[model samples]
Target: MGSSWLPEDAEGKTLALVLGCGAAVLLLLVVVVVVWTRRRRRKPFDISLEDINNDPISVKSAPTSRTPSPKLPKRLSCPDAFQFPKQSLLVRSMTVDRVPDFTLPPERVQPRANGEKGANTTPLQYQQSLIGSLQPDLYSHSSSFSEEEDNYLPMSTYGRLWYSIVYDAAVEQLNVTLIKVKDLPGRGSHRFPRDPYVKIFLLPDDRTCRTSKVRKRTLSPIFNENFVFQVSEDDIKNRVLRFSVYDVDKRKVRHSLGHVIVPLRDVDLGHVDTYWSDLEPMTQALSSLGEIQMSLCYNPQTEKIKIGVMKARNLKHADFDQDTRFYLRVQLFYGRKIHRTKRTGSRGASVEMDMNESLSFSVAGKQMDSCRLEAALMMTAQRNGGMLTHDVEYGRVVMGPFMYARGEELIHWQEMQAQPRVPITRWHALTSNVSHD
Candidate 1:
C-alpha cells in the first residue's frame, strides 16, 4: 500500500517540476525576443566587406538589365570649359561724371614772387611777345588742332602751374609729358640751348569706343576752345617757366605761338642737375662680337655728325658692302669730336683720322687730337616701341635706356655713376601710357 502511494506522489512531483521548467524556458525566450527587437530598431543596416567582395553564386550569369547606366567621370565638370558669348556682352562707357573743383579763383592769383620786373610781366605783354615769336608757317600748316584765341591766364603757384596744365590735358585724355627743363642759361647767356620738351597729343577719340555688333561709334573732338596756359612761380630768380602749343605733325618750334611766363620763386636749381648726368654717356652699345666700328648717331633735326665705315688697310675707302661687313660704331661727343674706333675684326692696325667732315685718303693721316667726344644723352619720348634703330650698310643694332612712349620722365640712372657699363643680359620692362589731349 505505501509503494503505490509513493509512485503517485512521485509522478505528481515530477509533472509539476517539468511544468515549472517549461514555463521558465518560455519566459527566457520572450525576454530574448524583446531585447533582440529593441537592438534591431536602434541599429542601422550595415553591409559587411566580406559579403560585398564575394561573387554572386549562380548557376548562370545574369544578362545586363536594360542599358547599363553610363560610367561617369570622377570629376563632375567636362575637361573643356563652357564658353560665354562675347558679342552679347556690353561694357558701359565710364564718364568722369563730374569735374572736381580744380581751378584757382581770380582773387587767389598772387603777384609774382620775383618782384614786378621779373614775375609781373603783364599777361597782355607776355601774349604779344609769344605771338610775335611763333612761326606762322607752323600754325597755318597744323590743321589737326584748333588755333588758340583766348587771352593767356597765368597759372597760380608752381605746384598749381605744373599740375593745372598737366591735369587739364589728362582730363581731356591726351598724352602730355613734363620733363625737367634743362640747360637754362643764367640770366642772359645762351651757350646751353637745351629746352625741356612737352609732347602734345591730338589722338583720335575713336580709341575710347569699343567694338559693337550693331554699329561703330563715331569720335568727337576733345576740346571746343583753345586753351590759354600760363605759369607763375614766386621762386625762380631770373628765368621764368613758359609753355607753347605747337603741332608736331607740322614740324615747327614756334616758341611763342601761345606763351605765358610765370615768375617762380624759390626755384630749386638742384632739380636741373638731375638730368645733367644723362649727357655723359654719348652712345652706349652692347655687342656679342669682339670688335665693333662706331658711327656717330646724329639728331635728325640737325645731323651734326656723319659716320662712314673705312677698311683698316685702305683708310681711303670707307665704303662698305655686304662682303665688307665690319662692326663699326662712331660716337659723336657734344657735336664736336668723332670717336671712331675699329670696334671689330683683326687688331694691330693703326686707324687714321681726319676732321672737317671730309675723308682724307692716306695711310699716315694725322690724328685730330683737338677733337673731344662726349655723350649728348637726352631722354626723349619713344615712338612705336620707344626703341631707336638706325639702318646702315653694316647691320642693325640695339640702343640702351629702353625708352617707351609714356608721360613718365623718370631717370634712367639713379645717379650718373650708377649707369651700367655693359648689359649682362637682356631685361624686360613694364609699359605705361599717358593721354592728355
Candidate 2:
C-alpha cells in the first residue's frame, strides 16, 4: 500500500540520489579524521614558555588549501621579537633598564648528605642576567682602560691595588712600586687565613718575576714594595707592566686573585706618579717578541737629532737558530731611511745584543716641528713553523716627534734652533710605531 501511494518512476531516482549523498558525506568524515589524527601525533607540545615554539629547523611552508583550516591555539610569540628568535650569543651595547636579582632555584635535593652539588645548581639565568650584563662593557670597551669600574671590581673577590712608577733620570732606571693593594678579597673555596702575594713583570723581559713576600692572614695587607727595571726613559715608554696577585695554596698552587696591566707609556715619567688600578682576570695569552733599549739626543749646532740602537734583551727564543740574532733599522717620521744597524750575531748564543752605532738625521734648513723617531727591531732567524722559512719580525718600537716640542706657535725647528745643547740621554722603550708624525 505504501508503494502504491509513493507511486512513481521518480521515486527510484530520488532514493538513488539520497544514497549517493550519504556515501559522499561518510567519505568526507573519514578524510577529516585521518588529517586530525596525523596532526595531533606529529607535534604534541609539553614545554616551558622560553623554549615554546622555538623551532629552528621547522620552517613553515605556505598552506596549499583554498578553505581555512580549523584554528588551533595561537602560540605566544613575545611582541618584542622582531624576527624569529635569533638565539644569538653576541649583541652590542645592551642598555638594561633594570637589574634582576636572580635567586637560586629551589634545591632539587635538599640534603647535602646525599652528596649532590648544590653550589653550581643555581640556574644559568642567575649567571646570565644582571651582574653579567656589565661584563662585556667592563672588559671589552677599552683594553687599555685603567679605571676602577672597568676592572671588574664586583665580579670577583680579588682585591684592587694602587701603584706608582718614578723614572730617575740620574740613575737611568724605573722605580716601580706596588704602593698598596687594598680590600684583598678572599674566596670561600679556600681555607681561611689566606697566604696572599703579588707578582710583577715588565713584559718581553720576564728574566725577572718580582713578587711580594706572602702576607699571611691579612685581608688588608699593605705591601709598600718597590721593584726596579734597569730601563731608560725612552725605553720604558714601549713596555707594559703586568701585575698579578695570587693566593699561595697549601699545595703550592697559585690560586689567582686577579691581574692588572700598566702601559709604561701611560705613566708620567716626568714625575713620581701614583695610580689606583683595578684588577682584572688574565684572559689574554700574550707572547713576547723581545725588548728594545735605545736613547735620543738633540744637537743644536749641528741641527741634527741622533738616535742610537743601544741593545735588545730577553728575546723569545727562535727554534730555527741555536743563537738568536737581529738588527735595527731606524726611520724618521717622514719615512726617511735614517740609519740601519750592522748585521751582527748574538753574543755566544745569548739573547742580548749591544749595537754601538748611532743614527743621525739632519733637521737643519727644515721645519723640525713634530719630529718623531721610530726604531724597528728585525731578526734573521728561521721560523719553526712553515708559515715562513726565512727571517721575520722580532720587534718594533717608536718615539715621539711631538714629545719634546717647546711651543706649538713656533716652527719645531725654530724652537730647537736656539735651545741649549743638551745631550739628552734617556732610556726610551721601543715599540711598533713606524708612522710619521
Candidate 3:
C-alpha cells in the first residue's frame, strides 16, 4: 500500500513540474516580443551634410530596392498649431554710425542803425550777456560779500580754519597753534550755533590725538591754543597733520563738520608760517595701524586648517605701563557666524612683535571654501590694582573670497585653495575699519 501511494504521489509531482515549465516558457516569449516591438518603434535621429550647411532638413523613409526614394523639400514650414512671426533672414550690421549733429546754427542779429556797438552779436554771445546780467559778480563787490561767501569756497566746504606750524629743531619739537574758525553753519530750525571742538591728529599715528576746548553758541570762535608734538626732524618730513572739527549737541552726540589735511612735506619747517585752509567735506579714510605677516594652510586629507601668525611690524606703540601686552586673535567664520576662536600668547608691546605661533581649526574639506578668517591685533594694559586689564583692538584684517575682503586679503585666500596642503604666506595691511564678520 505504501509503494502504491508513493508511485501516485511521484506521478502527480512530475505532472505539476511539467505545467510550471510550460508557463515559464510562455512568459519569456512575451518579454522578448515586447522588447522587439519597442525597438522597432524607436526612430533614428539623423543629420545630413545639408543640415551642417544650415540648409533645411527633410524627413525621409528608409530606402529599399522595391521602393523609390522620396523627394526632399527645399524649405521647411512651421506647423499651423504654433506659428512664429516671420523674421528677416538678412544679418543686420552691428557697426554704429556717428551721432548726427544736433546743434542748431547760431542765430544772427539784424544790423541796427550805423554806429551800434552790439548789432553783430551771435546767439551764444547774447545768452552770455543775459546770464551775466542776472548773476552777481563775486569779485566785483568784495566788500559786500557775506561771511559765508567770504572765502569763495565750494558748496562742499563748511568753513575755513586758520593755523600756524613751527618746527623747533633745537628742542626736537613741532608746535601747532590754532588761531580761529569762521562761518560755521547753523545746526537746526532755531539757527543756533554749534558747540564746536577740534581734534588734531599727526598722521601715520592716530593713536595719539589732541582735542581743543569746546566753544559754545558761536559761528566764529577764537581758540588761540597751542599744542606740541615731539618728533625728530627726519621723522617730521613723512608725517601729516589732520584737523577734524565736530559739533556736540545736548545729548552729547558729536556730529562731524569737516576736515583739513596738511602734508608736512610741502611746508617749510625751518620757519613759522600761518595758513588758512578750507574745511572740505569728510571722507572715510583707513587709519594706518600697521601690518601683519600670516600664513594659511589647508590639508584636505585631515580636513584641518592652520593659520600662522608670524609677526607684526610697524605696530602703533601705546603710552602704557610696562605691563602692556600685544597679541593676535584669529577667528574662523562659517555661515556668517563665528565657529572657532584662538589667540596667540601675548608679547611685550613694541614697534615689532615676533609671535611665531600657529593655530588650528577642525573643518570638513567641503567647508573650506565657505570659511573665512579674521586676524585682529589686540592690546591689553594692566590696571594699577593688577586684578583686571583693559583690552583694545588695534586693527583687524579679513581674509576670504567674499566681498568683505579686498586687495591682498582676497588674493591670499585664493592661493591657499590653489595649492592644497601647502602654506601661502603674505603680509597684510591692518585697517581700523575691517568688518569682523
Candidate 4:
C-alpha cells in the first residue's frame, strides 16, 4: 500500500489553522503601527538654558546637551532681600485710599490781571488762608461752647429745693417747712432709685440736727415736713440755716447730694414766704470730722519708728449705733506706698476713746524724711442678723513732710524729725478724704 504526505481529511484542518495565524499576525502589526505613531507625535520635556537663567529661584548649573540635567528649584538663600517688599505689600494692603470727610479740597491760585496765573501759593500760605476763612466760625463755635460751660452747673446743683422759714417771736422758735424738691438727677438705670431726705442744721451748732422722712424711688420728692429750731429773737439774726439733701443706701451710708445755706438776717422771717434755693456742693473740711491725738518717736540708732495713739476725742458718730466698735489703723508710707500697717484693739464707740496703744515700724533713718504716717479711725457694726459685719471709716489723719500733710500735720512731722528720741505728741483734726484700699 502507498501512503500520501497527509491524510485526505486533514486538508480542512490545515486551511483553518492558516487562516487563524494570518488574523493574529494582522492584529499584531496594527498594534505595532499605533504604538510607533504615538511615540513619534508625543513631545519630550525640554527646559532651556535661557529659561533657567531668567528664573531666579532655579538652580544654576553648567549647560548640559543631554536632557537638561534634572535639577530641583533652589530656595532663596537671602531672605532679607524680600523683607522690605513684604512689609511694603502689607502696608499697601492696609492703606485706605478714601479721603476723610473732615479734610478740605485744595484751593486754586487766582488768575492775574495780565492773563497769567498768579504765583502758585505755598502750602503754608494756603493753610493760612483756610485758617483765616474758618476763624469766624471757630470763634462762634467757641463762644457757644463757653456759653454752654457757663450754663453747666455741677452735680450738686442738679436739683432745687423749695422751703419756707418763719420766726415766731412769741414762742422764740424758728420754723422751717420743706415744700418739695424737683429735677433731681437720676442715678442710673441699673441702680436703685434714690431715697432722698433733707437734713436741717443750725450753722455753728451742727451738734443737733433734724432730718425729714425719706421719699423713695422719686426724682422729684414731696417732703411737706416741718422742723423747728429753738432760738432767741436776738440770736436768730446771727444764725444761718443749712439744708442738706442726702441719699441713704441700704448700708445706712449717707451720700450728700447737695446743700444750701440761708442767713436769717437776709430773709424777712416775719412773714411765711416760700423760697427756692439751688443746692451747692458740699465742702470737705477736716474740722467737720473730729480730732485725734498721736505721738511720734523715731530712733536713729535702731532705725525704728514708733507711733503712739495717745487718745481720740470728739469722734464723730456717723452711724449713731450703740453697738458700734471703733479701732485705730496706723499705716507707714514710704515713697507713696504703704510699707507697714498695724491696728489697735477695738474699743467701745464713744466721743472720747482712751487707746494708749503704741505701734512700731522698722524704717531706715534716711527713709524717715520720705516716710509718712496715716492714722484712720474705723468703726464696725453688726448687720444682717449679726452674721455680716460692715466696717466704715470714721475719719483719718496724715502726717508727713510731703505736700499731702498741711498745717498742723506738717508741723508734727517736723517736730518728730527735730527731736529723734523724744516723743512728739500732737492733736490733728481728722479729714473725711480717707484713702480706701
List the candidate numbers ranked by TM-score, top first: 3, 4, 2, 1
lDDT of 1 by residue, 65-147 (tens): 55656798687253333243666444446678698778766643335556544366667766665687786765332222122
TM-score of 3: 0.40
Model 1 clash tally? 33
Per-residue accuracy of model 3 over 124-231 as CA lDDT, tens digit each:
776677688776654232222244554575543487887888899999998888878877777976768899999898875655878999999987788988999997
Per-prediction TM-score: 0.18, 0.33, 0.40, 0.36
Q: Of the candidates shown, which would achieve the greatest lDDT relative to the real structure?
A: 3
The lDDT per prediction is 0.29, 0.59, 0.76, 0.75
Clashes of 2: 16
Cα RMSDs, all models: 28.1, 27.4, 24.1, 24.6
Measured with C-alpha atoms, the lDDT of residue 170 in candidate 4 is 99
Higher TM-score: candidate 1 or 2?
A: 2
Badly placed stretches (over 4 Å) of model 3 are 1-123, 132-287, 434-437
Candidate 4 lDDT over residue span 1-437, tens digit each: 48767877798799889999999999999999999888777723355878777876565465545466668898876655667765453232455689557966876664334643324667576567667876775432111122244246444446888788889999999988887887776676654468899888775465478999999988789998889999888778766687888887778766667777787779988777767777765432224456888898989898888889988876543555677898999888877788889999998877788999999989887776788888889988898778998888777888888455755687788888889999999787665533221
Model 3 residue 235 CA deviation in Å: 22
